[model samples]
Target: MVRGACTLTAERADTDRVLDALPGLWQGFSATLIRDCRLRFRRRSELANPLIFFALVVTLFPLGLAPDSTLLSGIAPGLLWVAALLAVLLSLDGLFRDDFDDGTLEQLLLAPQPAGVLVLAKIVAHWLTTGLPLALASPLLGIMLSLPGHSMGILMSTLLLGSATLSLVGAIGAALTVGLRRGGVLLSLLILPLYTPVLIFGAGTVRLAVEGAPLAPWLALMGAMLALSLLAAPWAAAAALKLSLDG
Candidate 1:
């Protein structure tokens, strides 16, 4: 009876500890998210780089191809997706680099809250600044690419879902390379293969929409990917950040 009572007491204590930590975890996450967003905003050039790249890629594609609306429309899904993917990649190299250089990253690792929570906050901030804008701006680019008006909604929706996964997966690569002097090239190499699945599902979903096919299955698959990334990516990125710091 004494032993059983002790086990129950310990379980209660553990539960209490988790409950107490919840508030701190939320505070840390919100602070980190707000701070990162503000910093990115202050750096206007950096903030605009991905959007500019996204637009430039879509704009140039038409000039290089024949002035054929049908052909452009046919290829629009893939073209828009590729532009967004590259835009995300372009922004990723600097995800953690500024913090690492300024020593804030080390402080973040040493903070009382779980590193994964803090890292997830940064990832959220990244998506807000980079991926969210890309999704919002995609319809204009879609029109330029001669994508059918009917598919514009799907294009934006797919990008909204897919880009979050990209940011999560890219954070792992960013954390791993945060300490390198020249990690951009290596970052791309590390994450591009991981990016393939998102690219496929994102482009395919839009393509299916353009073709007047059912979108449920493709959207379901993309949601699964996003869910898995949400569950796994932050912890993976936290571990990678530790490895980078230790090395």
Candidate 2:
């Protein structure tokens, strides 16, 4: 009986320690995020593809549409947002492919920390790689597109928020398709409809800027969408990942 009591106490102690550690478990975010960034940066082609795609789309639009600043300026907000959206979509297919291939994805799912938090960190790292660069590169593209110089801040701001939301939304689709051999095409199809509203508000925000109109309402909506995606996407992604694992 004494030995049984001692064993029960030890088990209780182990459970208590795990519960105590839960508070600090979110630090896993930093570790996973850093690791993701390091791995992505090591692959130069993967890191550069979306940025190149973004720039190419922006550069081609004015030539294709005629070089008139009036025409270009009118379409610039939608053009920029569309290009950035496609760039992110292009990158989304590979978001989980590497980890899924090498088995790190399995480890992540089984980790002591919540899988949702880990997935969120990874999505953030992806945005830092694919989305943030697009946002930063937009001002130069804004110039080429003949967007009003005064609205350059609006261009950058909208892309920053919109692209992060895209990354989060894209992660859910990527998780759903990660196990497939040719998921890229299907991934785009799955996520693009969901991406439409973000494109609308994002482009609208910049258009308001170009028109010298109040941007607060549009910007506020984009911010709300980002907040909603941040809160909900990780959990949805984790559930999708579990389904992938089960399959």
TM-score of 1: 0.90
Q: Which ten residues in a row have the lowest lDDT in candidate 2?
A: 17-26
lDDT of 1 at 2: 100
lDDT of candidate 2 over 162-235, digit per residue (tens): 99999999999999999988899999899999999999999988998988999988888999999999999999
Mark the regions of model 2 whose C-alpha exceeds 4 Å error after superposition: 1-23
CA lDDT of every candidate: 0.93, 0.92
TM-score, model 2 to reference: 0.91
Candidate number of the best TM-score:
2
lDDT of residue 152 for candidate 1: 95
